[model samples]
Target chain A: MSFPPLLEDLIRSLKVLPGVGAKSAQRMAFSLLEGDRLGGQKLAKTLAKAVDGIQHCTSCRNYTQSELCDICANPRRELNGEICVVATPSDVAAIEQTGHFQGRYFVLMGLLSPLDGIGPDELGLDRLANLMATTEVKELILATNPTVEGEATAHYIAEIAQQHNVRVSRIAQGVPVGGELEMVDGKTLGHAFSGRKTL
Target chain B: MSFPPLLEDLIRSLKVLPGVGAKSAQRMAFSLLEGDRLGGQKLAKTLAKAVDGIQHCTSCRNYTQSELCDICANPRRELNGEICVVATPSDVAAIEQTGHFQGRYFVLMGLLSPLDGIGPDELGLDRLANLMATTEVKELILATNPTVEGEATAHYIAEIAQQHNVRVSRIAQGVPVGGELEMVDGKTLGHAFSGRKTL
Candidate 1:
């Protein structure tokens, strides 16, 4: 059955969400309209507030309402001049969830994809360079993904940090923790063997 | 890093959507706030409009912005005295997609689940009674799901329609059209054999 104009519009708008196709968008729209009208209202308000209020952190490029994100604003995070650079805010959250990284983060917001018109400027590489030059940076941790673009972006960032005499380290690329050696890919296994440490 | 208040609230509210967990909600929030602010505003307006505008169709209990849904309002749909009774609006959409059934539909909105406090009143069986009393309904097609609750709901609806001298017919239940003989379960195989059609 054909839906009303507003509902059709709503379904179409819902499709803007990543991974939501026509069928999923219809389901979500119907579920919200039928089962959870209040929840739908809350989502609407939140969406409006987020779009209107949230902005990029001046220092790290992470999403925030203020000029600086919580991490950048916190004095505790500035204790050491160590920074972990990542491709997305989700990666920052993943690292934060582990409660392991104490230093601040520099979010690239995206990888350096020249084909997609996303270059070092798109990734705010100049801002990263400025941070490295101004701060008493001790180490730069390259925590981007292990994809080809990730590797290239890491190399580019490393070059910038090296020019400024900042030590650079990359997150290990090998068999994952608790991964079976037999199931490891040939390239990963080769890297694991080559990067092996003395017992 | 802790998200700002608005971003955090947006992420939490996003979890209200079906299948969205904390991480997915966070990702959605960030994507909207960072990448698609205008899309986010559009979604918000559409969501609010949908929630405020859509209502149940007075005749079939299907979702619509007006008193009568498209099917009920259409003159072509009222040519026959046949009504397909199903549980939800999705079922109506599924039936409509096939384009086989030309008759109107009566959406129960939900099946009979006494455990969940959904009884005859909740399914609007009285409204079905009212429709039978007023309309020239000749046949009441029980097109509910083939589950145990569906069977019970169908039977209950059938009894009500039978009392009004309306013929009751059920959609066939057996091995699916494309199902393999070996893969078919015992009950379905039995039904398939029992309900075999003449050549």
Candidate 2:
């Protein structure tokens, strides 16, 4: 039996999802057209809404709809004299899930990759500097990954923090080569970041 | 550092992506905030464009940019006694990828799972029945998966075709139990659907 043209388009577009190639897209398309209309509608609606509604936290560069994120706005987090620097808010949640760190986070959003023309400005190093200058934060923990890029980024930030009389430390051993914060486990992250040696 | 409310909402909202949990959402938020304004803008644009531009093919229920899907519109697909039935257009593409199954397709979209309240209408069986009545199809191959529900659906279609005086057959064996069409190798699918046994 032959169908009209409208059905084929929906099946093809589903291929855009990660790990979903042509075959999987067909399954998803069939499943949606056959089973999950609400799921499909929700996927379409929320994808757009999330993209449009979300923006970077001005202070830490975390995604936020309002002025501050949940961790940044919490008054209890302010009492801690430290700010954990990371490459993403996902890093923040990874740390927070452990229930170990009392301090809030300052997400770097990205690393300083000079080769890629990404500098301190692009990585929001100036934001960290501004925060150190204004706030009473004592320890600045660099929780970026252990990649060459991450190490270079940590060192770059450490040099700048030293200027503001801030104690800087990077996460120590535990992260494997080419590992990302998202892949690292919570228990290991606490050990790595807490046992960080002087950069 | 404390962030604003809107910023938090943005980060939190991103957690809803297919695999993105709270932490991943935060990471994405931070990534955007830290740098990669270009990447962020591109991601936003991609998401927006995909959602708005992608539509279902009227014929096969697959993803398409226009009214008719590429396969349905192609003149080459309209050769004699042609019309392969599948659960999705992905199946059509899979069969096409093998350079076999020269006939066009009718995507069943899904099996009839009455336990889930999915009947013929839900699976588009009625449209398929109507299609077979008018089309000059010489053979109808049931290319649905080998699942219990899929078998049941195949049986129901067989009965419907008997009433319509159409020659229908199920795809042949060698497909693993509970295996979906997308999971099987290309050669296997070509062999299985082509060698389908008559019900």
Candidate 3:
């Protein structure tokens, strides 16, 4: 038998989430309906609020409720003149959690994927260039992840920074801080050897 | 930096979903806010609709918008005199997908967990007894999971059926159908041996 109209619509709508399949969607539907009606109401209200209110920061493309995100609006981050270019907003959050980088960020919003039609324009490279022209950005750190598309995106952004005479540096790729040498992958080991630093 | 108030609230509300942690909730919030605002709106509308409209079926306690759930409303399922009793709506979905069971279902909604303050009334065992008394039920097949609480719930409901002189049967427990015997756990192996049928 089929679910009632609204229940069916809810299950279908829930499948849009990443990693959630038909079975998982059904499980989530039952969980919310059977156990937490208040939670469901809260989720609905929160989702509506976020969807209606949130917008991308004009300066950095990160999600924000105002014209500028907190990081972009911070006076200290603006003066730092160090912009870390990342693939997505989640990457911005990851770097922020580390508390090591005290500068700003530029969210590319996507990686370069020729097959998927995500080109320089799709990654908002032109917007990055415009931001570079308007600000006293001294350095551009390419912090895109190490994959084929990520590498292409980083290189593309590096070229853009070079055109603006801005110094470009890639985040070090090697053995992670606490990783075991034995567990490190072959390509990373190779990069570690080739990009070794002198004390 | 912390998320804005609405975003933070959305993330926290999302955590009430089963298996969603802080990181996952944040990701979901960002995904909805950044790229899929329409999806967020859809989810919100659907969730609100389901929560507000859906109600338990009077006969089977399964989710429904009408007085009776689809299964209980169907004349064919009602006349079959076979009631498959399960602990959750997901179980009903699983059994229905198999297409082997033509009879109706009785959803217990939860297992008997005395430690957590869940007892017979919480699982609605009295309601099951009432349904059995009123309906032309010939067999009560206990389809609860293989966990301890599931077992207790099944036995409790079975006793209830027995009190009304109704035949009660538990779904089999053993090594899974395609599972290797060598890799099977001891308790399941023991049940497999004890419940062996004549060749």
All models, RMSD in angstroms: 2.7, 7.9, 3.2
State chain A's TM-score for model 1: 0.96
- Lowest summed lDDT across 10 adjacent residues in model 2 chain A is found at A1-10
For candidate 3, write residues A1-199 as lDDT tens digits: 3577888899999987767788888889999998899999989988888889888788888878899999899999989999999988778878888898999999988899988788988877888999889889989999999998888888888888999999999998889999999999999999999999889
Better of 1 and 3 by lDDT: 1
TM-score of each: 0.89, 0.62, 0.86
Q: Candidate 1, residues B1-199: lDDT per residue as tens digits?
A: 4667887799889888888898788778767776788888999999998899999899999989899999999977888778999998889888998988998899998899999999999888999999999988978999999889999999999899889999999999788888789999898899888998999
Docking class of 3: medium
lDDT of 2 by residue, B68-135 (tens): 77776777775555666676555666777777677667776566877878788876777777767876
Instruction: Pick the DockQ winner.
Output: 1
**Model 3's DockQ?**
0.56
DockQ of 1: 0.61
Residue-level lDDT of model 2, residues A1-199, one tens digit each, is 2223334454444444444465555555455544445555545444445546667667777767767777778778877888998886557767887787888788776777878888888878888899999988979988888778988888888898999989988766666678998989997788678776786
The most accurate candidate by TM-score is 1
TM-score of chain B of 3: 0.93
Error of 1 at B182 (Å): 5.3
Model 2: residues >4 Å from true position, as ranges?
A: A1-34, A68-80, A97-104, A112-118, A146-152, A169-199, B1-82, B95-104, B112-137, B145-156, B169-199
